[model samples]
Target chain A: MRKISAEKIIAVISRLCIQSNCQINEDLITSLKHARGKEQGRARMVLASILKNIKIAQREKLPVCQDTGMAIVFLEIGDKLKIDLGEFLSLSALVQEGVRRGYQSGYLRKSIVEPLSRVNTEDNTPAIIREKIVAGNRLKIKLLIKGFGAENMAKTSMLRPDAGEAGIKRFTLDSVKKAGSHPCPPMVIGIGIGGTMQKAVSLAEEALLEPVKSKRAYFRGCPGLKSKIKRLEEELLREINQLNIGPAGLGGETTALSVKIKTFPTHIAGLPVAVNISCWANRHQEIIL
Target chain B: MKTKRIFAPLTSEGIKKLETGDEVLLSGIIYTARDAAHQRMTKNLKKLPFDLKGQIIYYTGPTPPSPGKIIGSCGPTTSYRMDPYTPSLLKLGLKGTIGKGERSQEVKEAIKRYSAVYFIAFGGCGALYSQFIKKTTLIAYLDLGCESILKLEVEDFPLLVGIDACGRDIYQQQKT
Candidate 1:
């Protein structure tokens, strides 16, 4: 068994919280540049400002957006890996400690609030953690800092099994159209198809972590299923951009930078679909130990 | 495409001249207030931190500044959240507001009724916007942390006139 120290895990999570919020990933930067090239008028101007903001954030070691966002941590632990939980009751406590330290030290905003009382959780604690056990002995930690602007626009639907792909397409397009400019334009669209309602939503959130137009080779399914998903992603990207919501929704040909879809097998009688929209600053980072 | 330079504490004539889609470089003082502060201010109108006459409120809740920085990543939040409280503030002679996203028809009509303007700072451009903010002073609601009312002195802040005093809305104009 490979033992990972609690201290190491906490330190890594802390660093990731700060790093992910401050840095714009290369793939997203490239996608934004491509979108900028295709934009004109106000859209072009918005893109220019966004690109400059990314640079300033990096140079100054500041968050790309003021809404540092709620931390969503994904941990894939290897079956053979064991965590030494020193002084902490569980792995989750360590993760939350990391987030608290990171947000405090990084000067990131404390955005999470008690839903009903609307009181701020000053240190940005209790991150949403998703864990899975995989085959290898390596531990992989992925952090997605989700801002509320786009998150508020997320949607899920239980479509009829007969509805199939066409249903998903219509639902996604309608959601984006209805969203208009609120979620911030040139957004990244994450779609989850199949699975139960909550599972589909989680899958969509996971899809946002994938780099734009990048293929996932690890999908376990039929031989051609991966390619089929890729094709659908491309089609969705095309149609979403054609909406003309544009950059900042001021009007242009580049409304969405990318559309990623993740699928899982569901009950034969039910088809669940969920859409998670992320703003241009789709902040996420991963580390493997 | 021509950039018009304007100062805050906006004048009625100045606001009246601005049309939808006019690019503006705003300087001078504006105040920052987001959802929490807005709710508090609108709820207790008798004890406002400052006079609303001719002032602009930026709908933003910036990250805490790092050491030696005037402010952290500071950009516009969605404007529509403040739609409920906006007409009242506009009625109180608030000259303009800065935020991102479309406003309701009620707010647009109120803008016309009160001869106020609405400007949009580039959404998600927090880091870029930070450079324009010269100074920030906490004005009220200290308990709200980042959502506290702050008096910010800005210089050459980029903005696009979204809704002008005449009720012309850039969002509506651009959509068609």
Candidate 2:
């Protein structure tokens, strides 16, 4: 069994928190550049400003956005791997410690607040963590810094099974139209369909972890099901971009850079759909051990 | 597009000159306030840490600056959340506000009523905005951390007129 210390995990996560916030992913950068090429007028200017901001953030080791966002940690642990929990009660506690340390040391913003009291947590702690066990003896950690601007735009619906593909497309388009420029388009849209409400939401978020140009073969399903999901993603991307929301919602043909959909078998009576919109920044990183 | 250059502590005459879709480069002093500070200021209007007259308030909560920097990544937060508190501030002679996204119909009307303006900094372009901020001084609500009210001296901070004093709103104009 491969043994990993909790302290090591904490240290790695701490560094990742800082690194992910400062660095713009290469794929996202490429997508933005491509979008910029296609945009004109105010939309083009907005994309240019976004690209400049990314450069400055990287050079100065600064956050790309002021809203440093809530830290979401995704863990996929191998069944054969052993974790030395050390003094921590659970893996989550260690991860939280790492996030707290990282945010403080990196000068990232502490955005988490008490829901009712509205008091700032001051440490950016209580990170949202999702864990899964896998067959291999490798542990993978992925972090997504989810800002609330786009997160607030997320929507979900329990559509009738008959709503099917067309219904899903309409709901997504309507959501994007209502969102307009609020979520900071060009957006990366994640669509989750065919599951319980909570599961659908979770799946949508999971889909966001994939790179903007990722091949849609990561999820387990029959080939027919996979092709259908891929086709839906392409169609949604094209339709959403046609919304003319553009970059910064000022108007253009690049409202959405990518639309990714993840699905699961659902009860015959319900077709739960959730849409999670991510702003252009789309900050995230992953590590494997 | 020709970008107009403007300064803060905006006067009625200067604001009147702006129109929806005007690209602007703003300089001079502005105050920063986000959700927490807005809540506190609106709740105790008379006890505000700074005067509202002719001052521009930026709806932002910046990251803490790294060593040797004046400020950290700073950009506009969504403006809609401040809609409820805005009319009151506008009434108190708040000349303008800086943020991203749309405002409510009421707030847009209030802007015209008060002869003020609403400017939009490029959303998510925090690092770019930070370069324009030459200095930052804490004004109030220190306990709020990043949400604390701050007096920021900015130079050529890029922005667009989202809602001009005449009540022309770029967001509404851009809608299909």
Candidate 3:
């Protein structure tokens, strides 16, 4: 068994929490610049301001947005790997320690408040962590700092099995329209189709982790499935952008930057769909060890 | 498309002249308060530490400042979350507010009735906004951390008149 120190995980996560917030992802910057080119008037002005804000945040080692966001950690651990915890009890505890250290040292705003007492947690700890066992002996950790401005606009629906592609398209378009500028357009929309309700939501988030310009591959023998998914993504992207929500919702042609969709098999009777919207500050990164 | 420079403790006449979509560079004092502080203030309206008269409250919860800096990434939070508390504050002579996103119909009515205006700073531009905030002091609800009420001295802060005193809303115009 390959033994890895839990402390290493803690340290990595600490640095990641700080780094993700400070550095606006390059893909998002490129996309924003592209959108800026197509936009006019107030939309162009809004995009320019966002790009400028990103540059300042990078130069000064400050958060791009005031809402540093909730730390979401995705861990892919190899079954052949064993962790050397020493006195650390669980992997989650170590991750929480990292979050605590990062939030305190990085001067990030403590946003997690108790639901009942309404008291601030002070330390943005106990991050939303999703772990899975994979094939290799390598461990890959991915972190995404999700700002609530866009997260609050997420939508999930369970449609009739017979709803078909048109129904799916309509729901997606309606959700984006209702969201309008609230989620901070130009948005990167993540669509999760099929699976159980929670699974669909998680899949939508996973789709977001994919780089904005990444390619969509067709399933080798399943042409029908491949075409359906690709068409859905293309259509959604086209329709949502047409909403004219623009950048900062002013009014323009560049509303959505991209629409990424992830699908999985689900119960025969249920057709679940989840839409996760991310703002211009698309902060997420992955590290393989 | 008109640009104007204004100071805080805004006057009714000055706000009336402003229309939705006008760009303004704001200066002078503004107060910062977000979810937690708003809840507490509304619950105990009489015990508010700072007077609301002729004052403008910014809906934001900024990051803690690094060493030797006046403040950290300070930007507006979603304004709709503060809608319930806003009408009450507007009733107390609050002349203006700054935030992003759409306000409720009732909040817009309060803006019309109380002769208040709502401005929207660029959302997600925290670092840029911090450059405009010259100074900041903790005014109330310190225990709330970032959610505490902060008195900020600002200079040439950029904003768009989202809703004018006449209830002309830029967001509504854009949506339509």
Candidate 4:
């Protein structure tokens, strides 16, 4: 078994929290630059302003957005890996500790609150963590700072088996239209297809971490399925951008920057789809150990 | 269509002159309030530490200040989250609000009826906007952390008139 210090985990998480917030990921920056070239009028101005904002935030090491967002951490742990820690009995406690330390030390806003009572947690602890066991001895961690503006616009549906590809496309388009200016267009769409409702939602959330326009090699061995899914993603991207919602919803040619789709096996009777949107300031980071 | 410079304690004439798609460089004092602060203020308007009449509210929940800085990255939150409570506040003589995203029809109507204007700062440009804020003072609802009410002194703060008092709305214009 490979043993890792939980303190190291805390340090990594703390750094990733600050890093993800203060800097726009390079892939997202690349996408924005591409969008800027294609946009016009007020949308072009908006994109230019966004680019300027990113530069300033980077120079000063400030968060790109005020919301700071809820920290969602994904942990891919090897079956042979074990953690050594003092007060924390479970992996979750270690993760929460990391979040608490990260938010406080990084000067991030404490956004998590007690849902019903409406009291602030103060440290932004208890991150939404999804842990999975895989084959190697290495551990991989991905942290996504999900701002509420885009998150509030997420849509999900459990479609009938007969709904098929066209139905899914229609649902996605309808969501983009209804969302309009609220989610901070141009948006990066993360879609999860198949599986149960909750599973699809989780998949959608995980898919946001993938680099823009990158493909999943899970079905690489079966080129037919892979190519089909790739085509669907491309079509969704094209259709979403045609919405003309523009940057900050000011009306322009580029409504969305990218559409990433991840799918899973589902029950024969069910076809669940989830759309998780990310604003242009797509903030996320990864750490490998 | 044109960038205009305006000071706070906005007059009815000033509100009327503002139109959709107009750029603004707003100066003077503005109050900060987000979801929790708005909820509490709407529930107990009398308990508010500051006057609502003719004051502007910026819908923001800022990150804690980094050492020696006056304020941290501060930007507008989505306006729709406060839609349910906006009409009540507008009726109390609140002259304007600054936030990102489109307001609801009810909010747009309330802005017209109350002779108020709605402005939007660049969404996600918190760091850039922070440069405009001269000072920030915690005004009320301290227990709410970032969502606490804050009074801010600003100069040349950039905004776009999203909805004007005459019922002209930039967001609606964009849809067509």
Candidate 5:
């Protein structure tokens, strides 16, 4: 078993937290510019200006988008990991330490509050991490910092088994319509199908981490699954863009740039569907070591 | 449409010239308080902590500041979350409010009643927004930490007026 230093994990995630708060993945920029080409009217111009701002923020070492989202951590651990659960706490103290350090050092805005009290901690720390133990020797980490603007607009439904594909499509369309201009147009969509309620949410989030290109590491893990999900995603992408939500929810054809679906075998009693909407800036990156 | 620059710590005249659909670039003093502050502001029977008259309030709870910086990556939170307490603040003679997302009808009606406007400075552009905020100070509610009311001095901040006093909401105009 190779030794992995605890401090090293803490340090890397710290930098990642700050970097996620500062820079958006360049892939999202490319996708957005492509979407911009497909749009018209004020929506198109809004996208054009957004492109300009992205450049400005990058050159100046500033955050690419506003609404510096709440911090989310995805951890992939390997077997024979030597870290003590006793040291890990109920969750991991190191993770929270990274959040505290990252947000404070990076000057990221803190957004957590005493839930009901609604007080802001302003550190943006006390982040959320979802971790799993998988077949591996090294650790992998991904930060998909999510802003409230887009997160607030996410919707999910527990569809009846007989709802069928047509019903699914109609529900998806209705949800987007109800969301309308709120989630910020030109959104990246993650559709989760065929899972339990909570699992569906996880699947949607997992799908968001997939690469904008056709080949995705997350999807690669499960053999023969890509083509099936890929077709559904592209079809949904076409339908959502047709809605004309545009950039910033202004009317136009490019409301959604791309849609990716992730499915899991669920109990026959439930067919849960969830939509995880992300704004134009798909600010996420992964490190698999 | 062409945009014009205006200063915050707004005046009655500043409030008047602004109409629905007019884009504005604001400078001068601004304040930030999110959901918690709204609750307390509405809950207290006592006098409010600040002279809210003619002040612009930004509905945001930014990232904490790094070493030596005045504030963190600051951007607007959703406006609708604070809708419940907005009418009372408007009646207290506040100039304007900035936030991301939309507002409720009650707040809109209160805005019309008080002749105040709502502006937006981009939803997730925290890094961009922080650049305009030249300085910041904790004004009140220290117990609340980041939710504590903050006094921010800004310059050349760009925004679009989402709602105007004459009973017009740009979102409403856009929808109809």
Candidate 6:
């Protein structure tokens, strides 16, 4: 078993926390630029300005569009790598520690709270994590700073077995249209298909981390059924963007920046679909060691 | 098509000129309060730190700026979230609201009853909104962290009247 120090994980994630809080992934930016070209009129202008501001945010190391986001961490641990669980939490404590420091050090807003009472937690710590076990001895961590604008806009539907791709496309587009300007466009659409409803949602979340428009989309790479799913993804994204919801839904053209679809197997009766959208800022970063 | 340039302490004449979709550039003083601050302020309107009567409220709680800036990208948070606290303030003669997205039925009715208008500054256009805010003062709720009240002195901030006092909503009106 490969043993690692708790401090090493903390140090690594802490730095990732700080830097990722402000950096917009370059692939996402490239996709936005592509969307901008296709967009028309006011939508195009807004996309231009947003892209420009993102550039400014990067050059200056500012949070790449405020609403800094709920820190969602995805951790992949190889079974061969053994570490004390308590030690991991100790290292994990600094996720919030780093967030508190980073937000304070850079003067970003403290976003965590008591859910019902809505009281600020002062320090934006206690990061959310999803842990997975896989085949290697290596540890990989990815952080996605998901802003609320898009979070509130997420939707999931457990489709009937006969719903098919047509129903899937209709549901996804309807969600975006109902969302209107609320989620902050142009949007990165992460769609999780198949599996159980919850699994689909989780897969949707995972799919959001994939490179935009890659032949390897967030869901475009799921094995076994991926070959069948890729065509459906391309069709879905093309149709959704054509809805002309446009940037910020101000009525021009180009609503979604990219539609990433991920799917998995499920009981024959269930055809679940889930969508997780990222706002124009699309802030995320990953570290694998 | 209506167009108006109204400032703090909205006057009837100022509210009269606004249309559902006309582009408006606003100036003068406006107080900043997001949902939390709005709740607190409405709870004690009679005993509040600052009077809200007739003052335009920009529904935003901006991030504290990095070094050398007065405010970070200060844009409007979603106004629908503030629907509960809004009508109470409108009944108290709060002039108008500036933010983005649709308002609730109660908020729309409150606008009609109170002669108030809901203006929409473009959502996510924080840098542009930041340009109009010339000065910023941390007014109240100092312990509320970033959700605290801020008094901003703005100049010619642009907005769209989403809801008019006559029970006409631009979002609804323009849909057809």
DockQ of each: 0.84, 0.87, 0.80, 0.83, 0.41, 0.40
Encode model 4's per-residue lDDT on A155-206: one tens digit a residue: 9999998899999999999988888888778888888888899988988888
Model 1 spans with C-alpha error above 4 angstroms: A217-220
DockQ winner between candidates 3 and 6: 3
Kindly list the per-residue Cα lDDT of model 3 for residues A1-289, writing each as its tens digit. 8989978888888888899888877888998998889888899999999999999998877888899998999999999988887678888888788888889899888888777997778898669999999987888999998999899999999999988778889988998887776777788888888889998899899888878887772233344887777777888888888888888888898888888888888788989999999887778988987
- lDDT values for all models: 0.91, 0.91, 0.87, 0.88, 0.76, 0.75
Select the stronger candidate by DockQ from 1 and 3: 1
**Which stretches of model 4 miss by more than 4 angstroms?**
A217-223
Cα lDDT tens digits for candidate 5, A195-268: 68898889888878877765552353457677767666777778887776666655678777777787877677
- Against the hidden reference, what TM-scores do the models get? 0.98, 0.98, 0.97, 0.97, 0.89, 0.88
How well is each residue in A65-181 modelled by candidate 1, as lDDT tens digits? 999999999999999999999999999999999899999999999998888888888999879999999998899999999998889889999999999789999999999998888
Query: What is candidate 2's lDDT per residue for B1-176, written digit by digit as tens?
Result: 78999998898788988999998999999999987888899898888899899999999999998899999999999888899999999998899999988899999999999999999988899998999999999979999988899999999999999999889989779874
* Superior by TM-score: candidate 1 or candidate 6: 1
lDDT for residue A247 in candidate 5, whole number 0-100: 69
Give a tens-digit lDDT track for model 1, residues B1-176.
67999999899878878988999999999999999999999998877899999999999999999999999999899888899999989888898999988999999999999989999987788999999999999989999888999999999999999999889998888878
lDDT of 2 by residue, A1-289 (tens): 8999998999999999998889889999999999999888899999999999999998888899998899999999999999999999988899999999999999999989889987889899989999999998888999999999999999999999899899999999999988888988899988888779999999899888888998754456566887778888998899988888889888899999888899888998989999999998888999998
Worst 10 contiguous positions by lDDT, candidate 5 chain A? A213-222
Docking category of candidate 5: acceptable
Taking candidate 1, what TM-score does its chain B reach relative to the real chain B? Answer: 0.98
True contacts kept of each: 0.74, 0.86, 0.73, 0.80, 0.38, 0.24
Candidate 6: clashing pairs of residues: A96-A125, A219-A262
Q: TM-score, chain B only, every model?
A: 0.98, 0.98, 0.97, 0.97, 0.94, 0.93
